[model samples]
Target chain A: MSAKEITVALVGNPNTGKSTLFNALTGLRQKVGNYPGVTVARKSGRCDCGDGLIVELVDLPGLYSLAAASPDEQVVTDVLLGSLEGSQQPDAIVVVLDATNLLRNLFLASQLAELNLPLALVLNQADVAHEHGLKIDTQLLSQRLGGVPVVLTSAWKGEGIASVRRAIAEVLNKKTKLARLTWPAQVESGLETIVRAVQADTGRAPSMADAQRILFSSDAHTSNRLGWKLSQRETVVRQARDQVRAAGFNPLAAEPLIHYAHLRKVLDGVTSGGAGKQGNAAALDRVLLHRVMGPILFTGIMLGLFASVFWLAKFPMQWIQSGVDFLKSVAAPALAGTPMLQSLVTDGIIAGVGAFLAFLPQILILFLFVGILEDSGYMARAAFIMDRLFSWCGLNGKSFVPLLSGFACAIPGLLSTRTIEDPKARLATAFAVPFMSCSARFPIYALMCAAFIGPLYGPGWESVVMVGMHCVGLIFAVPTAFVLTRFILKVKPQPFVLELPRYQMPKPRDVLWRMWQNAAEFISKAGTVIFAITIIIWALCYFPRDAQMAEKIRAAEPALSTHELQARTQAAMIEQSWMGRFGKAVQPVFDPCGFDWKITVGVLASFPAREVIVSTLGVTYSIGKGAEADSQHLRQAMQEAKWLSGPRTGAPIFSLAAVLALMVFFALCSQCGPTIATLAQETGGWKWAAASFFYMTILAWIMAVVVYQTVIRIL
Target chain B: MDWLIIGAIVGSAAGWLIARAIKGFQARRKGGCAGGCGCADKIQPPKK
Candidate 1:
């Protein structure tokens, strides 16, 4: 630890603007959302407090109390006590309180007062309180809290941030500790007993705050942390609860009752007026959260967002395609003498990159809508709506956040399962999270829709198909979770408790920043992973050049043009190449799913990451080809593809059934390597990961085959 | 000569990709996010 650096922990209840304030203090773009559980891990950044003093700010997960009901809450409890491994006790604490709802927020602030650590109270959302016509007397509150510094802040607007920094510096300089509340003598005695018992068990006396936590918490999280034997801890806890009963108080209800009573007196006259008349939020929620209308509105919003993505991104996609074609045209002539180089540059790199990049605008637009949804506070309501559906399946509303996050990527979504208190529910949610149709699967759906569905059935059907593909995974995921929770895990139903934040207009800067970040990430993957995969696929499809194959084709068809002879030779060579042979060997397995050898090869090559399928198809179709210009685009190449063997020989390979089947397979398959590994870590074994992989793979195959056969029969 | 050059470029790409995949697998096995989704850095444990 540097002499000039002091660590301050930011603690608050969920949706109290703790993360927003953390971002403001550190100037780092930590993920901030209008809902709770958005931040499930500890994040820290340094702030220059101006005067050669650097403050290391640790942003802990949001929790209602220090009872540690969930894994994320345990992190906060562990960090505050300096018991978390590799972390020191914070030098000071900044307790963020929702200024408009101080009475509820002060419950957490009251508990922190007993820690005897230097503290500052940030009445965040001050702007909201002001707009609500609520007035807080900071000086009175500070005086009541034993001279601790108090500052008002509206973090999202960057209002009063400088005052917050000054308050932090002042609290540290003055070493101002919050005034501790007086507990009932009986409760105090019970706490003393637990404190002594803990000291005897662990050979160290615990702080009063820790003693209170152990005595009052219904869960064994505190004793478990102390490494106490279950039998011993239970006996000690029972004895302490008996003491509380002697004072006519239930041990479970005693802490909140005592704290609230004391806080009511201390905060008397510190706040005046209320937001009054329930405001616009209440009026809006009446409609948005209405039983019948909420779900219908949600469906409509989802459809509209996806339709906009397809309709809006079409122009940019065409521009990118044209640019790629131009580049290929210029490079083809320059390297005409070197056929291999020409193919590698024009067919492998440019085509592969272009195919992937054309979907960038779609990905960006989708993220922009998601960002607005998240920032507007509608995500919580959506979760509230989903809870009714999830409860029957043995999961709760908390699982919805992680499931929603999975649409962005499964890694963080799996990690966010820490917020679910029920072990069985968490595991079930983690198992189903990978099936949320992540953004990596978006390009495949977009390409299939654009190449076939759009042109055939118009943009309306294209948009519907795009939305349907996104829903395919969720449609399957719910049933999987139901079976796991009911038949295997037998999870008990848990209540969904969520505090909905006020609805606010989406911040344009944040939304655009999110879009830009996601777009850059997509571009980076295209340059690296997609680039490498394309080169390898191109090589595999272009090797063992046979000059006699062209001659044989020319001799067999005397009327063939030179271009036709070259195209025939290239196709035959690809069928004979290493990847071609491998794909053919595996093609039988996917034949029932309406997949040709080329599609099978692309699917196999994308096992490491799903998005590589686009690049793989690009390289497979473009290598060793002449500049026909018409077939340069990936969509054109796919549309022109035909089956070379079997009873369906000479028929178009990508029928509507086949295209839909391909999209279904990608949507359901557990193909992402990192997602599988994350599942292993979260579930505490590789067995669960293995089961998920095999189960999803078989399920995807069966579903694809079913779609293919049913659709083909109908057609 | 063009065949040799193409083979070298392809082989090098294959070799590099193989090494990267192996490294990523090992990292993921140890509970690190190698998802290449730009979240690994953000999701890390608190600094020592």
Candidate 2:
């Protein structure tokens, strides 16, 4: 390939603005995907090198070092070591170092410099560095690295893109004059001996960087890339480690000391004036990380986030609800001639599906606040404050991110456990994640709360109840995690370590983009999973249509009051229907929990997903005597729902006690099919998923029974 | 006329839903997060 088409890889630590620099260099010119055979995101962009030249720039995942501990770090190692399939070794490397945190950023740079490849350095976030009173001497710093080209750029503000491009273009074809980082004399000699033998055995030249990676990594991919036998590699590495230790300095610990010592020399006097920013940061951290105030502030922020989901979304939610009602009204008139058809169209299609879609606004609003916290770097602080609470459960603070993500959707939340590092803690997080009240549960909570709580207690109390219902899962997470970690998994927990990023102003475009993406995903899932469930439920209730029941009601219409006749006829029609019979069969089991046969049927039908409960209820009531396709009508029917004939005859079924029981059931229920599938996939076996499903369902049932019996006795 | 419109609506909706389910199943089989999971393109294949 021509030098213009040479592939250059961009590497950096997390939050170093490497991605922002990549975007600045290759605006509107990137293709995003996963690396072959692994799930790590691979982002490649075509960058124009300012003259008839263009280079393909691939931005690899952020990392702290070359060590491959997690799958994400594995991809970075594969790419740098040329072990990844379907990808050529990068012809050039550009390391983006955060100028504000040069001391740490230089650690990765120093590691990469050992590789014999063409390389350039971009001191990104230079403006931020200047604002913090750190002035970098670029020429001196570059000269220290044997005259490698260095460019100062502020990628966030669109400054110095051209200079970075030029620097990369200059080194696109030339090989770096690679220097081996000096270790203790004995360890250095041992590395040389291993490198020579590896070259002699495979007849492939090996750099000291190659030897270091092979020794540190036990991943098969790394071994395969180095062309070393796994057993032989393991034995040789152990031997070398022992030899280096015997020579005086600790073997494994000596390399970092040597690299950092050299970096200290090179970076000397290259930057100055950090005391002001450090003092400012320390002052802020004192309050934000306060023992007394930190937890309270975290709780307040969480309360604000959840509150916005209900408050800011109210107008848009109402607009959506009105549209659903309109659809039902139009369809009702259009299908008036066919009662069965009319019921199915209005009740099944419109009301059932409409209720789920109406909550789309709240989902987007939830993600908006989340995106702000994440992008502004406050998310780490949230976890930091929650560490004390998590530690008691044998999990550390790192597990909190996954738990928080469960609010959006349990699938993604469960998937994010990869960052927890400790397998025991990660699995424990997965086990407890389902209790975190995912967005799917929000539809059930929202519809139920607004229909009952909003009217009786008003919106203020409605929001409080909504947020409280959401927290039910969070309230139980600690105990659930403790049980799984101590008794179930029987594993010890690892210490947690997290780096808090410097807080910065969040970019609006990024936040809006994230919101739009989340909305699209929610909308897409609604059309398939939610829509399919609505149709199935609508069909179930519409079937075994009893025309005779209607005729009997008409015959008694003159003798009986209209409301009584309508109620009796509707009750008779449902009793003979398939679902009503099924509900009756299941009713005895649910008696203690305050649910009658009809509610039991709704619960059973919603097994595929939790959000289906709203739609199922919509379908059920629409088929009953007081069938109304709108929200107000359904709420009215629920309020009037009564036992047909018993000691509790003529008593409303959905009483205050019953409603609370049902809320408790759903708050703790493992009802979503997607969560089951995801948990199974995440835990790598059906055992944990089955266990999670079992415990949550049993817990939900027991909680509902407790709530109902206690409330009944008090009343 | 009502039958024709109803038939068309049911047929098309079923077709669309089936097509989407098939597409989603295929995506899941390709070794990543399921489509309903927000992390479909981002998460690794099923872990051990």
Best of the candidates, TM-score: 1
**Alpha-carbon error at A521 in model 2, in Å?**
2.9
Candidate 1 per-residue C-alpha lDDT over A1-715 given as tens digits, one digit per residue, 9 for 90 to 100: 4433589999999898999899999988867888888988878888766667778888889988877888888888888988888778899999999998888888988888877899999999898888888999999999998999999999989998898889888888999999999877877888888888888988878888888888888777777777776876778889889999998888899888888998899889999988664567898898889899998998889889989999898898899888898898788889999978988888888888888988998999999999999899998888888777767877766899899889889988999999998889899999999999899999999999999999989888887898799889988899999999999999888777788888888889888988898998999888888888888888888776676887788888989887787787788888888888999999999999999988999999988899999988888887634456424688888898888779999989999999999999999998898888889988998999999999999999999999999999999
Candidate 1: docking tier: medium
Tell me each candidate's TM-score. 0.97, 0.88
Summed backbone clashes in each candidate are 0, 0
lDDT of 1 at A133: 83
lDDT scores for all predictions?
0.87, 0.74
Instruction: Put down candidate 2 lDDT per residue, A246-302, tens digits, no spaces.
Output: 666565566566678888888899887764466666777788889889887876777
State the interface C-alpha RMSD of candidate 2: 5.7
Total backbone collisions, model 2: 0
Runs in model 1 lying further than 4 Å from the true structure: A1-5, A629-631, B29-31, B46-48
